[model samples]
Target: MAVSFHVRSSSYPSRQHPQAAHVDEQLTRLRSSETASSSSIRQRLSNLQDLHDSLEKMIRLSVTNHALSQDQIEKVLDGSIKILDLCNVAKDALSQMKEGLMEIQSILRRKRGDISAEVKKYLASRKFLKKSFQKVLKSLKTSQNKNNNDALAVFGEAETVTIALFETLFSFMSGSKACGKWSLVSKMMSQSKVTCETDANEFTRVDMEFQSEKSLQMEDVQNLESCIQDLEDGIGSLSKSLIKYRVSILNI
Candidate 1:
C-alpha cells in the first residue's frame, strides 16, 4: 500500500521569470520618460533668465543715450547765447565809429567854407587893382608930351608884373579846385559809415596830398606878393617920371 508518487519537474526556462522581466522593462521606460521631462523644464528656465538679462541691458543703454543728448543740447544753447552777445557788442562799436566820422565831416565842411570866403576877398582886391592900373595906362597913352614914350614903357613893365602876379593867384585857386581836399574827406566819411573796418590807410594818403597842395599854395602866395612889390616900385618910378615931365612942360 506504499505506492511510489513521483513529483513532476517544471518545463519553463530555469534562468528567467516571465513576470519579473515584464516588470523590469516597464520600470526602465518610466525612468527614461522622467529624465526627458526634467531636461525640457531646465531648458525653459534658462531661456527665461537670458531674456531678462537682455531687457536689463537695453534699458541701461537707453538711459545713457538720453542723458548724453540732454547734455549736448545744453552746451549748444550756451554757445548760441555767447555768439549773440558778441554780435551786439560789435554792432554798438560800429555805430559809435559812424558818429565820430560824421563830426569830422562837419568840421571839414566849415573849414572849407572859410577858405572859400578868403579866396573871394582876395580875388575882389585883385580886380580893383587891375582896373586902377588900366586907367593910369590909358591916361599916359592919350597925353601928348616928349616924355610920353618913356612913361608908356614904364607903365607897360608895371602891367606885365601885375599880370604875372594875377596869374600866380589864378593858378593857386585852380589847384585848390582840382585837388578837392574837402571832397576826398567827405568820401572817406561816407565809406566809414558803410563799414566797420578802419580807413586809416586811405585817410593818410588823402592827408599827404592835402599837405603837399597846401605847401604849393603858400609858395604861390609868396611869389604873388613879390610880384606885387615889384609892380608897386615900377608904378612909383613912372609917377616920378610923369611929375618931372609935367614940370618941364610948365617951364616951357
Candidate 2:
C-alpha cells in the first residue's frame, strides 16, 4: 500500500489570487468613475464657456450702440454750428453790399447828373463791378440754401441713427424683445442682471444639492458659491458700464 498526499492545482483561483484580483477590480472601477467625472466636468466647463461668450457678445453690442449714439449726436451738433456760421456769413455780405451802395450814391451826388468824360470812363469800367456784384449775390444765395439743406439732412440722419441705437440697446437691456426708451432700457438691464444672478446662484445651489453629501466638503461648497458670486458681479458691472456710456453720449 502506498500513502497518497492530495495536491491542489494553483490554477483554481483561491485566497492567494483573490487579493490581486480584488485590487484589479478596484482599479477598474476607479478608472471608470474618474472617466465619468471628467466627462461631467468637461460638460460643465463647456456650458460656462458658452455663457461667457454670450455675455461678451452682449457687452460688445452695448459698446457699439454707445459709440453710434455719440457719433450721431456729434454730427447733429456740428450741423447746427455750421448753419449758424452760414447765417453769419450771409449777414456780413449783405452789410457790405449796403455800405457799397451808400458810397456809390454819394459819388453820384457829386457828379450832378451832367458827369464829365472821366466820370463816363469810370461808369464804363463799372461794368466789371456790376458783374462782380451779381456773381457775389448769386453765390451767397446758393451757398446759404445749400448749407440749410445740408443741415436739415444731417439733423434727420442723426435722429434716425440715434433712434436705431436706442432700439438696439433697449432690446438687449430689457430682454423684452420690444423697443423702448433709454430710461426704461436702463432699468430693465439692471433688473435683468439681478435675475440672471439669482438664477445662476439657484443653479449652483441645486448642483451642490445633487452631489453626494459624503463627497463634498464645506470648503468645496464655499468655493463653488464664490465662483457664482463672481460671475454675477462681473455681469452686473458690465451692465452698469453700458448704461453709463449711453448716458454720457446723450449728454454730449
Q: Which candidate is the best by TM-score?
A: 1
| lDDT (tens digit, per residue) of candidate 1 on 207-239 | 333345443233333343333343333333333
TM-score per candidate, chains pooled: 0.25, 0.22
Once superposed on the true structure, which residue ranges of model 1 sit more than 4 Å away at CA?
1-114, 127-216
Name the Cα RMSD for model 2: 37.3
Q: Cα miss at 240, model 2 (Å)? A: 39
lDDT of 2 by residue, 75-160 (tens): 54444343334323323432433343334345545755432333344333334444543444333211111223321332332222
**Candidate that scores best on lDDT:** 2
- Any idea how many clashes model 1 has? 0
Compared with the true structure, model 1 gives a TM-score of 0.25
